[model samples]
Target: MSETIPAGKGISAAQSKIENRLIETVVESFNKTEDPRLKVLMQSLTRHLHNFLREVRLTEDEWRTAIDFLTTAGHITDGKRQEFVLLSDVLGLSMQTIAMNNQAYKGATEATVFGPFFLENAPEIAIGGDIAGGAAGQPCWVEGTVTDSSASPVPGARIEVWEADEEGFYDVQYGDGRIAGRAHLFADENGKYAFWGLTPTPYPIPDDGPVGQLLESVGRSPVRASHLHFMVSADGLRSLVTHIFVAGDPQIEIGDSVFGVKDSLIKSFETQPAGTPTPDGRDLDGKAWARTRFDIVLAPALT
Candidate 1:
């Protein structure tokens, strides 16, 4: 038996034991996978996961706890909801990833989170119409323009919008009420869009999972700032996920539960007089609402 140890093999046994088994599994699965995109995804995921475990020196107990947390997250998820999405949102990972991927759109409308409450079947409404449909909260009018990188109007753009009610609850949250104030509108030939919706209020993220536990441990609140969510897409233009902040909402400039606020996304709600009839014959008493006009510029889609 050799008495002296090899210079770099002092922990050979431990190193072998500590080798990333997850990556090994991924590699085995990758060998069996045929889709090129799936292959790339698995490979990248394996690399990052292995690197993370190695960098953090993840312990068995910690790993087990993480697995348990993920399991609980899945248990809490349903067809209409995703606990993982809520986790990512509260941790700011969702917005950060979106920002990283959307960096190509310089000088265009800044992007934000799509959130977890978007609906594909929002009622279509005309420009300058009131989307709030008589819900409480501060009365607000939201208007905007949709344009391209060159400042040219993105005519016929479709803007999908949704937000919470005066009580800071969405239609899904109410569970029994009608889905009012949620709709999709097409930009006119000039790319201008406008609507009346209540000013978004700072609302708490769902607090019923391991992610919520993490937030509580950090002494962090789950309140997001006031803002309206928008999905803007147009012919020959890239789709954008974004929001307009309530200018007077204090949360706009402060820290958010999900870190979704952006300075460029903020706009002022100019006050208007009472008795403005929306295209649908809905009279908007401007005195009872805060009005804003915002414009979004989209990038041309690649391919």
Candidate 2:
């Protein structure tokens, strides 16, 4: 025998039927997609998106607000500023994508977000040279070695480094087309590299746009811990993009705004008094300096 439904239950069941038909129609529209992967992706995306809308009983106003926020984020993006990447970062989507793509490897350095600030074709600097370019900050000596998984030095690997100054400003922030605290260098025959850079200081992710507004609405701080960025690459090895975070930085303990910090990537920066001999023999004018050593291990490239 057929069961009778109450009046409210009947209405709900009819509404659910309409929702299911809409989802099914949207998903079926992608059935003719040329790429198998794209077809699957579109179908899955439609299903999940429809489910989320139903689960939330989303209002039209809320959906419109989200659309407007994303539109504003795109409108503000330019050559030196990337608001979309910043949004992904603050939302932790960037780190989640990185983690999914970069599986852990024994002895290889853990990868982190390839922040929006990386510039292509950065001017190459000689070993032990100063990358700070007289930018304002305490003198810091950065020395490191590049090796393979087996611990053998991988000489001649390319290392690209960039960081903010003591005042917590990147070169791009100045908008003067001046390059500071960023350079490319190569490891020596013994896989050793050293350069002079400024001590990294905590700074906010460019929070002047919609992403910033989102952070404010969520009661979240926009500060990133002090860190030096690196992109190391060698032939026949998978490139490593990562950062060396300052040990004991309050932001690191509290959590980096971009979710990029890994406990394994933190290293202490030792303080040296003024007049100490610099590792690169560059004259520091008797200024007190900080120094740290980082070693990198690369994994073999997938064939």
Candidate 3:
């Protein structure tokens, strides 16, 4: 069937009707919600969605196709995975939100979008321990300090860390619970923490949706830079979700398919001995990798 709108179909009039109905539905739903945040979110989303439809002069067929794509995205999701987060990442919406909310940390430590693969069960390890579990990749020791904005150490802070293996795959991606290149470490009494993990590598976002099509259409690559994800929390300090990008990783400058790259987030990954005993207390020599120290300074909570 030809997917063209029929002549004299009153496109504008139809759009007006649909838009009015949408606004009414949104207002009704918002009124039924008690959460202030949800109300703001729903109202803003409704206004923007309506504006977008009107601006684009969307046709019924296109809207239906879009809905179908979204449905398929949901269908593709299962335990240990989320296609919606993938969708958000590909559209750059995730990074945009992180950037907007982290504006206060611009000069301090830039934030990036957390991908869908981070799992909470990262094995806990001591300082100088390895998160690589046992993956083949460049050996890198990541050390850093967790502190408040004033540069005072926040000892006993918990840092949740995870990254892809040397082969550019996370534990979830591998689907084997290997937990390679992932760990959770606690800051010592000095607020200092360090661990070893395989240096990250550029990897592609899933490319099987409208978002993927959008990236291809724009002549963009779906690769993200090598980086380690970190979520740090401590008493009396605001929590932070951030990443440490490998400096000089070509992907950092060009291939962040999610638009999440920032100069401030990049750090040098220095060469280290390969014979470094694996994080498991076993001697594994000749494992070449990079090392870097990253310090995170958090903002004090507003009373």
Candidate 4:
């Protein structure tokens, strides 16, 4: 057999020179960036992007398609929808970034993706109150304590919680502009908190946009495991963003669509019969309810 030729071996010298010059010009354009970090980021991004194009031998049509895809993703993004974040989630880039930034700390809760659904300044509720906000789902009682790495109580900690209803829909999913199943509360003086929420259930990521189409093209499902989202913070401690996934959620063994689950974050949701007294003495009055406990351990903040 004749010897095989290496790829790009037939390119003329002029073509090779133009490719090199293009990358060099792009990198040099960032040399005047006022911020050193920004300069480094731009140069590195330019080099890597050029290398990727060369490695893939990307076609002009493919580049145009990518640009169009990004443009569509941007256009579909709005206050309640985040297509870019959805893209990153489906790509596993969000999990990779979270892992790199949140190295394991002793006794501290592991951090996970913030998710695209988190709302800032959610309505605050008092302890033992319900966050269901008239959403439809089986009732659940979530109780937990905030503690330092040493397991000492951290009073007055802020805890923000949000989740979808049993039907796998969040408050934002409704078109009538109603908020449900989300609330923020402060821990009691004993570092304890309790609130009623809906039982966590599996749900599909919003799948009507460009990101959804991308997942379909790749033959990937958009279903995430059942879980309740939490953001816990206190003075002098590093805030934790995490989830307590429902134990035995079938999707738990399967990978989460957003790659958010950690084995340490799974907990059982104990089902109580009707008329069971809740931790705060709220009578379920013959309605089944679920209860779960999740204590958060926070690391000391850096000075």
Candidate 5:
């Protein structure tokens, strides 16, 4: 599918006037919506959509092609794969929606796109346990503290962590049943948390469907910056779904296909030679490992 709408001379002024009248009628029809928020949403959506159609003088053939593309996207979607999320990510709508919803608080960790790979009910781990669970990669020791914007420890905060293995394939991507490179653990009494994980590597978004074809037509790469996913939450605190990107990953400068990177989210991973004492004393069997710290600060809930 073509990524850009073909440039047109735009609709004539007379056509635009008639289009505006239709937009008015559509907006008025939504005024009867019982929910005020729904009413505004429908009216605004109608206006913007009509405006877009008019602005481009959208051709019937192009519109039909778009419909066909979306139909194919819908047809390929399933429980394990979400084509719509991929569409939104490629269009930058996912990141834009996240930005619009996540308000900034003093020194709180910034949030980023929650990629569609997260699964509910991940296996639980103790405060200082391994989340790797048999995934393949260089061992990494991840440590962090969960705190509020005021710098007070938020004990018992639940942190969900997941990442792709060294080969850039999430466990879910394999046909065989396997649970690896993902787990959740709660903060200790002082808000400290630690776990063993694989060092995150750069990977391409699932670009095998309509979304991929569209990107190729438009000359965009589907690779995301190397990073690890995190979702943190505690009572009365705003939940955060974000990622900590590896510092000095060349992909960071190359760009993330989903536009999920932030300078604040980047951190260094200290390299440790083989046989270095593991933080939680789990032996790596003579393999080199890495360590990184992420001190997370969450904002208060919007009441």
Candidate 6:
């Protein structure tokens, strides 16, 4: 017998007996799980995890390192940052989960990963109000209407929006307790909504943590594509979480680090030279601005 188990060599009844017995022992321990779904999940997780360890011939040192990595991820998570979400994003698991949960239903807007920056109790704004709240970036005019799958306007739908500023940092990244570049507001009776927001820009996901180290070990970039986030919900409709990517962003062709981009979500951001009249006649003081329209269609909720 070699020092390491031979890759893919068939294990005999006696040879694998000990390891297989251990797997069965662990799986059987979950038999008392009261929830049927939980019991299946635990047993399946045990089987797959054991199979992976056997296939990869993982060492004690590697297992220890993985435990340490998760510990660090948990330690760094808080009100503002989520290292586990970053871990899941980089591993493509986040997008996979989103895809499974938000299936296609009529003309419903495509759903994407809910990045880690969302905060509850965001201050509400009125129609044509500024969601930017003074985050630094080129001003943009965003307008859209919320409609149901049947094409009827969903009056009073709630929309929450957030994004990183021009410097590639969200408001929560600052320790001074600043709030900007995010707000929630309701659609008007006509299902129309509009707000001022900073132009979305490409930025790297926070890279000073364990998730960053893992990405570095695998030679993967930590930068996310330029895009704006949106979470729209209305009574009796499936809530949608998605983003609109700038149509010409070079990163889209390269790749979104979180695998959150979709062709249907890409929209042109019309550039306006300095002195262009604002949508609501707000003064830009000679600074250039941009505008984009995103009409959202939502799917029906499961009863």
RMSD of each: 4.8, 3.9, 5.3, 4.2, 4.0, 3.3
Q: Estimate each model's TM-score.
A: 0.85, 0.94, 0.85, 0.93, 0.94, 0.96
Error of 3 at 1 (Å): 39
All candidates' lDDT scores?
Answer: 0.76, 0.88, 0.76, 0.88, 0.88, 0.91
- Per-residue lDDT over 59-84 for candidate 4, one digit per residue giving the tens place of the 0 to 100 score: 99999999999999999898988989
State the lDDT of candidate 5 residue by residue for 1-303, as single tens digits: 112223346546676566667777888888789999998888878877877886777799999999999999999888777889999988899889988889788888999998878888899999878888898899988998999988999999999999999988888888587888899999999999999898889999888899999999999999999999999999999999999999999999998999999999999999999988987788778999999999999999992
Tens-digit lDDT track for model 3 on 1-303?
A: 112222233567675665667666765667767898997788777777766676677899999988998888788787777889988887778988986777674235556788888787778999888887877777677888887777788899999998887667777877776667778889999899988777778888767666677678789897888788998888876677888888888877577877777777788887756665544454545656566889888876542
> For model 1, what is the error of residue 44's alpha carbon versus the real structure, in angstroms, after optimal superposition?
2.5
Model 6 Cα lDDT, one tens digit per residue, 113-135: 89999999888999989988888
- Please write out the lDDT profile of model 2 over residues 22-140, one tens digit for every residue: 78788888878999999888888888887777777789999999999999988999888899999999988999998977788776899999888888887899998889986899988
Task: State the local distance difference test value for candidate 4.
Answer: 0.88
Let me know the TM-score candidate 4 reaches against the reference structure.
Answer: 0.93
Winner of 2 and 3 under TM-score: 2
Model 1: ten consecutive residues of lowest lDDT: 1-10
Instruction: Give the Cα error of residue 214 in candidate 6, in Å.
Output: 0.9
Over 4 Å off in model 1, which ranges? 1-13, 16-29, 104-106, 271-287
Return the lDDT, model 5, position 107: 83
Q: Is candidate 1 or candidate 5 better by lDDT?
A: 5
* lDDT (C-alpha) at residue 96 in model 5: 93
Which candidate's TM-score is highest?
6
lDDT of 4 at 262: 94
Pairs of residues at least 3 apart in sequence or in different chains that clash in candidate 3: 138-289, 139-289, 270-291, 274-286, 274-287, 275-285, 275-286
Model 5 residue 254 CA deviation (Å) reads: 0.6
Model 2 weakest lDDT span, ten residues long: 1-10
